[model samples]
Target: MARTDTAFRVIAVPPARAFAALVDPAALTAWLPPEGMSGRFDHFDARPGGAYRMVLTYADASAAPGKATPGSDVVEARFVDIVPGVRVEQAVDFVSEDPAFAGTMLMVWEVTGVEGGTRVDIRAHDVPAGISAEDHAEGLASSLANLAAYLER
Candidate 1:
């Protein structure tokens, strides 16, 4: 249903470093969650049409511990396009027979090499209209921050 998504842009210290951080598990885990949260890829195949899955854990909201999700959310995607250290596009889905995401979702990541690092732009289209834009935006912003932090280190 048309394109309804959030956009966030951030500069990475080094463009190549930013690209490298995305594919590395250690790097990925280091910066992929919001403050007070953590996550990592379980088994990621970054190639086109590859299966990508990641597990995210939220910290307890209070003094008590939190209940973790049983499994990682799985998405079925086909690499629609890829340019090494430059950009990537993937057709991802929720993997449910449900009509919500039974269709193709286009996730485009464009990275431009700048003087000091890189400017990255991400757009996820075909998102169900049912989801909240605020949540989506916040998640992506946190992820970008995480990515930046990982690269800086």
Candidate 2:
């Protein structure tokens, strides 16, 4: 069976602003990486049918080895659906030699206006078995926290 991981955060920004950050490579690189990791984009095109490649590097490889490389996790993602100021859906694949990590994961990011700000929801489906549930949950929470901090500043 496929696994799904979800997370949400109320950011102190409007839906449009949050949506902008989702498609902006610079903004994504600033907030998408979890704690103890940094990210860089090899290429980014934010539009339907467009794709992006991102490399996330762990600060301490000894603590957690990467899926793609010893210290980095490389991801190639295609934009499956893009609704400005509303939602962004993607098909993501990890660049890994391990067969356990070989599969496309569906990711949906939705932003809706809330009372104080915008609510950002992230749903990741078909997460690879190579990624532990606990680690995935922690990573999702960390990224959401980072997004909140980035937008609230």
Candidate 3:
């Protein structure tokens, strides 16, 4: 069995702003990063069973396709739970013919009401055997940093 890890960060923007930064496709693009990467929401019904998909492109030519990390060039997911303006949970999986995923990636993006803004907690489970918990952790942190930057701007 693979181990699952939780990554969390408390955003400083107000709830509305934080939430806006979350659901707004443009806002998400502004911060979602790692060089050569961008994403768009396919259909954010924002409720359970609502489907969502995103495209991730390799920014670097030197990187092999198999080396494309999670959220690197492609991601498709569905909302597992949504609490309007409060929280959004997702079941995410990698969409790849890369022979790596073999199946969909399962993940959750949880937003909670905090003192000033919202707390973001990302739980990624059933991670592929080759995936790196440390790299994912760094990526999560970077994304949160980008989110903060976008929200504050």
Please report the candidate that would top TM-score against the real structure: 2
Candidate 2 Cα deviation (angstroms), residue 115: 0.9
Give each model's clash number: 2, 0, 4
Q: For all the candidates, what are their Cα RMSDs to the real structure?
A: 4.0, 0.6, 3.1
Report the lDDT tens digits of candidate 2 across residue range 25-98: 99999999999999999999999999999999999999999998999999999999999889999999999999
CA lDDT of each prediction against the hidden true structure: 0.65, 0.96, 0.68
**Runs in model 2 lying further than 4 Å from the true structure:** none
Q: Give the top-scoring candidate (lDDT).
A: 2
Poorly placed runs, candidate 1 (over 4 Å):
60-76, 95-103
Q: Write the per-residue lDDT of candidate 3 for residues 66-153, one digit (tens) a residue.
A: 3345335566778777676666666777765566555545676667878877788777777765557786777778888888777776
RMSD after Cα superposition, model 1: 4.0
lDDT of 1 by residue, 27-89 (tens): 766876666676665577767556666555556545323223333234545667677898778
Which residue window of length 10 is worst by lDDT in model 2? 9-18
Q: What are the runs in model 3 whose C-alpha is more than 4 Å off?
A: 41-45, 63-72
Clash pairs of candidate 1? 48-79, 49-79
Better of 2 and 3 by lDDT: 2
Candidate 1 Cα deviation (angstroms), residue 81:
2.5
Of the two candidates 1 and 3, the one with more favorable TM-score, higher being better, is 3
